[model samples]
Target: MLNLGTVLAFGALVLFGGWAVAAGVATRSLSAVNAVFLSYVASLTLVGGYVLSVRRPISGTGTDVAFALLSGAFLAIGSISFYAALERGSVAIVSAIAALYFVVPVVVGVLYFEADLSTANVAGIGLAIVAVVLIAS
Candidate 1:
């Protein structure tokens, strides 16, 4: 049986998949920067409203706040680059290539966090490499 986290994650995947398709379609009419800007504005409003409704304290350590800002910077950069790529390239190819971003965190987890890579994880990484090569060619 799927746990709550797994169910929520699946829901997120479904929503994100729909968002990706909508983004690709919308980018045809809007510039990448504009699209990202508008999309994030909406994101902020919704998320901010949720926080307000929850009445949760927005407390975090200095380091946590700094890390969150840094993460947002990275996400903004990546989103702009991705949207730009989608503008100039085939959406299918661009998305497939972009989807390999999971490898970065996987590598960090293994190398820096001392996370173990089981046989299936290794096989998935190998298959991801092969998929990239096949897609790029």
Candidate 2:
């Protein structure tokens, strides 16, 4: 029987694969900014409704709304840039380069959150960087 970690890993892989396929379809159908905006709005509607229904109201300073809007704006820009890269480069190359975002959270966790990285995780990070370099080259 598969372990919990293995099951979670498999699920993540499936989710990412599905996301890539859907993104490709979306890119083909509309401008990446449009695709991103529509998707974000839809997701916000669903997730926001669920949260409001299930969770107690938090104190919403204007800062909270500003932050959420800023995040959505950044996501839209990133998606547009990615779609543009895909147009100019091979999908495989663009995807491999884009995968470097995985490092962003790790770096933020270490630098800002003071999370400890195991030796194995450090090695994994090194390997990921090397893979990105090789794939981009």
Candidate 3:
């Protein structure tokens, strides 16, 4: 039987693949900045409301909120850059480059959270880097 981790990883892959497809479609229909802004607004509205209703108050310090906002700004910039890339390059190429985020998040996870990495994880990251090199070329 498939283990829980395998199932969850598959689910995440499916979700992110779907999101990338949707982002491509949105890029075709709207400006990237607008697309990102609208999507974030709608998602945050629902999620924030649910959190407020079901959980404790968001008691973050001002600095914490500012840092979160800064991170979001970077995300917005990245989305805009991606849309620009899609406009200039083939969707397949752009998508492949964007998928390099998988490797990035793994490195960031290890660095920021001191997450333990298995041999498989390192191999996966190496393969992803190779894929990016091939795709970019």
For model 3, the superposed segments whose C-alpha errors exceed 4 Å read 1-9, 60-67, 105-121
Order the candidate numbers by TM-score, best to worst. Answer: 1, 3, 2
Q: lDDT tens digits, residues 27-131, model 3?
A: 786877787777678778998999988988767999998989898888778877887776567777788888887677677889998999999988988888788
Candidate of highest lDDT: 1
Query: In terms of lDDT, which candidate is stronger, 1 or 3?
Result: 1
- Provide the TM-score for each candidate, comma-separated: 0.92, 0.67, 0.68
Q: Candidate 2 residues 42-137, lDDT tens each?
A: 878998999989987766789997988898787778877877675566677788888788798899899999999999999999999898899889
Q: Which ten residues in a row have the lowest lDDT in candidate 1?
A: 14-23
> In model 3, what is the error at residue 41, expressed in angstroms?
2.7
Clashing pairs in 3: none
Candidate 1 backbone collisions, by pair? none
User: lDDT rank, highest first?
Assistant: 1, 3, 2
The window of 10 residues in a row where model 2 has the poorest summed lDDT is 83-92
